[model samples]
Target: MPQSETLRAQAAPPRLRWWTELPLILLVYACYSAGRLLARDDVTTAVDHGLAILRIEKSLHLNAEHPLNRLFTQEAWLGVPADFWYASLHYLITPALLVWLFRSRAVRYRAARTWLMTSTFLGLIGFTLLPTCPPRLLDAGHGFVDTMAQYSAYGWWGGEASAPRGMGNLTNQYAAMPSLHVGWALWCGVMLWRFGGTRLAKTAGVVYPLVTTIVVMGTANHYFLDAAAGAAVMGVGLLLTPLMLRAADRVRGSFALRSGRSPEASPVRSPQVSKGPRASIVSGGCQTSAGERFPRQRESALPTGAGPDASPADTGDGAPAAAR
Candidate 1:
């Protein structure tokens, strides 16, 4: 194989274990949550950014959020379900797809997981740089309703974002520029469409992300621009995943070197031999018993009175005599 092909084969997905994967996933999620909390900006600035986005959307004739938000707000059936979808699916479906990939399509799991994590961190950077508020967080004068708050009585979430009732403060409500709900949904959709192996999965792949984009907007949790940004973030993450995997491999190689082992080392093997008895060649057309130095000259062939110390001439076999 070519060197590139050899490296590719060597870098194939390794066997996964729940014990290790669970901790890694939890760590990334913890970082994601903590990052949101740490990247929070003041309300005034976030609201200004939100207003700016709305103005831009209006200018571009892409203010789809208004109609959808109004519909979702006026119809309780739509609003309540939209709220549930916005709050629950964002947390549930991403992890469920991850578990599914790990179990059934492990070959693609690592890249998909890496892409998600990379995009999440990138979203964190956006949250820090531009902490834009969601449409629902804007003043009522702006004509958007907080569906989660409106439908709070029906579910475990509170008015503040998607956290359970009293735990609302635990989440950051201003990180709305790049909607990871949409980004993660896109990731899940791609995974299902590419590796799902069934028509139902492929159909769900197309529908899930499309519905999530609408759900986020309809519930007033994200703007059209925010959904677009989320997808852009995922695209950037996909581009960076190969570099990330290569960097990880280098780190692993360095660790192996530090531990005095080569990552590419092959096992040592012994030479094979048959189990049958063996013989040693003494001379042309002659063999000797195992461990014997040479074929002994027959008594009749031996010169008369010649002893064991006789030279090759006396033996007449032309074999060299034993060393003195």
Candidate 2:
């Protein structure tokens, strides 16, 4: 078989253990969160950045959040549900979809996971570079309501970005440019639409991200442009997935080589007896019935008392000689 095919045939399938993935995912998220914290600017800086973005939106005539925010806040019933969806779905749905993919769609799970992770990392970089505030955190003069704070008495989340009371400091409120909420929601939708077993599943995937985008905007947690940037990041990540997988494979192969591990054990050495009237060639040394032992041959070596050009098995005796 060809060497590449041999290596591929011997390669093991990817492992999808929850116990391993859970910790790794948590660690990556923790690092992302911690990095956001370190990158956070003062409230004034964040708010100023947000205002600048809002101005740009106005210039582009794309400030959809104005009407959406007003409409959602005017109706208490609508606002409450939007708040819940914004806070809960991003955390709940994405992970559930990922777990489902890992368990049921093992073949596709790696690409999906890599895409999600890459997009998340890109979002983190955006957070570090442009620490813009979400609409909810802006000054009250801007007319943006803190919907979660308004419904704080109903849910476990405190007023600050759906985090638990007093623990809100652990979260970076300024990481708002490339909202992971919309990014992850869109990722879940894409994966489901692409891999779902049924039409309903695919339709749900399409509807879920759309709903998530509306919820984020209506709840004042993210601006319309933030959602766009989030989807853009996801698109970039998807585009880079093939390259990332190839790089990962190369790194794995290099590591295996450095560790002196072969993909499979060496082929077993067996004795080969010539069917023609010549001596047999045993890969490893073997003994004859006459109690004589023969060692393995070096290509340059000649038999004892034989000329340099003598045939290896030209002895007059009929008995075949062992590989010397």
Candidate 3:
């Protein structure tokens, strides 16, 4: 290959197309959703677990969802908007932020995506293990009214919390302990705050997660502890990210090495025998059959009369040069 072409290839590593990771991302989410459904225990068992959580909340005076639920249901306008926000933002905002990061912040996008996916799977584990219920689905005497159902006239949700009209059956209603709505919102908030260029953008980041927390509570879809657990799961994901990446890199390196290839290795040149052991000076560099590349120094650094015939090791003192 031409020397110029080789140099350009070596200058920078190739970047993967942004869309390449999309399939993997989608597959992980699909698995998480399916896993949550399969993770479901008996309804009776789940209800008992839900009651246990509510009882614990009462003991600690954290059973604030009752008042929030009443306020939302008492005001139709407020309840409708809250339902919309709860249903739409959880799905829309998170994906929009992900697309934005992929398109605009390529460098940080991988870490962010990994962290988000990891946290989601972690939440799935919680759903699988606990199968706790949302506040709205609790018994009627608990005063935790299903605001989504009450405001179903204002929106399309059925009795389920923010679920679609007839599609409530498809959702994992018991996966309510670790609120991914709050978790994903918090993740978006953190990314925007850290990477956003403007003050207004940063402020929006802070407001979004807080508003989401209130929405989840007011909608009676999650307890305060659920939101906290979501944030905690995300924190664990962040901490595990570096270790995960490092382990992944090591496995990749091992595969490449075992296959007798280095991803970053330079192009191999077939050696060409030259008469009388010659060297070539290329643009911006030197090339030798011995496989050495010396970067070109300033033109003035060479002796005043040096030319194509100049000795490889010729100093101004003019001694016999060493053979490279």
Candidate 4:
């Protein structure tokens, strides 16, 4: 194989674990759907807990003035407009990649999409369970904007800020405990590491999370803890992705074994038969090994008037028709 093709085969992601993901994704969505509707007690407490953390940070000298406070305070890029990247562009990418995978060789995209989807599902759980309000919502007591609520056209409000169009357009307006932004960036980094051969490309891929972390904090959009949680979630997703791929490979192997026997593993099965030096010949057709002449070849250009048991004129003693 060519060098690039060889490298691609080596770097390709694992096979699809369709059976596992189909049900697992359904279960996850179901649980979250329940949380969205049924867990009012847990939901209320999570929001309270998030508020308590903000208070604790204030008393322990970790308040808005602390360098870590940048996660909830600074707005250095205030001069920029709010329309540059207000929408959740990343969300759009996941669905598009999913459709692309469905139409093409599914192996690579399956693992990646599962990881992204599962992680996003988990993030929704965190949102309802911890209901974090970003720093932009801080007001003056160390003010913070609900980054999830604010939709900046282009400005970087810092803690992975975005300009959401409206609350109705988003899934959860408060799911900021773990920034899926950072998680997807980590995912992209791994993908680049696995498939990108150039050192510079890999370097760029790896450095993005660090920059993203800064952008998120500087804009008061996420607390340091939120970004940490996002990274933790991606780590779990990465580990889960490979386990699924291996299981699918095992299933595919079993299926291929049952399809058809290998060519070399069985005797050829032709039906024509005869006796004598030119016994395998036919009058105007191809003969099978058991003397049953297959009639299809009667019209093809034959050398001359040959018949059943007629040996090739070129051979004095035809040797089993030279093994077609």
RMSD of every candidate to native, in Å, equals 9.7, 7.4, 7.9, 11.2
In the range 125-218, model 4's lDDT, one tens digit per residue, is 6766667655555445654444333434334332233532343322443566787667766776666565556898589568766766655554
- The whole-model C-alpha lDDT of candidate 2 against the native structure comes to 0.78
Q: RMSD (Cα, Å) of candidate 4?
A: 11.2
Compare candidates 2 and 3 on lDDT and give the better one. 2
lDDT of 2 by residue, 1-324 (tens): 334444555455345688888997898778777877965657788889899989989899897787888888788888888888877888788888888988888888888898888888888889888889999988899878877888788777898887778888888888888878889989988888998879998999899999989988888889988999999999999998888887877777778789997533335434444332333333334323222324442232333564343553533344444554
Worst 10 residues of 2 by lDDT: 284-293
Worst 10 residues of 4 by lDDT: 78-87
**Clash pairs (backbone) in predicted model 2:** none
Question: Candidate 1: lDDT over CA atoms?
Answer: 0.82
Stretches off by above 4 angstroms in model 2 are: 2-13, 263-324
Better of 3 and 4 by lDDT: 3
Work out the TM-score per prediction.
0.79, 0.78, 0.77, 0.52
Residues 1-324 of candidate 1 have per-residue lDDT tens digits of 333444445543445688999999999899888878765658889999999999999899898898999999899999898888988888899999999988987878888889999999899899888989899888889999988898999999888888998998888899898999999999989988999899999999999999999999999999999999999999999999999988977887888789997665333333332233333344332554432344464322333554454445543354544544
Predicted structure 3: lDDT: 0.77
What would the TM-score be for candidate 1 when compared with the true structure? 0.79
Shift of residue 13 alpha carbon in model 2, Å: 4.9
**What is the C-alpha local distance difference test score of each model?**
0.82, 0.78, 0.77, 0.53
Mark the regions of model 4 whose C-alpha exceeds 4 Å error after superposition. Answer: 1-46, 55-89, 92-107, 145-171, 246-324
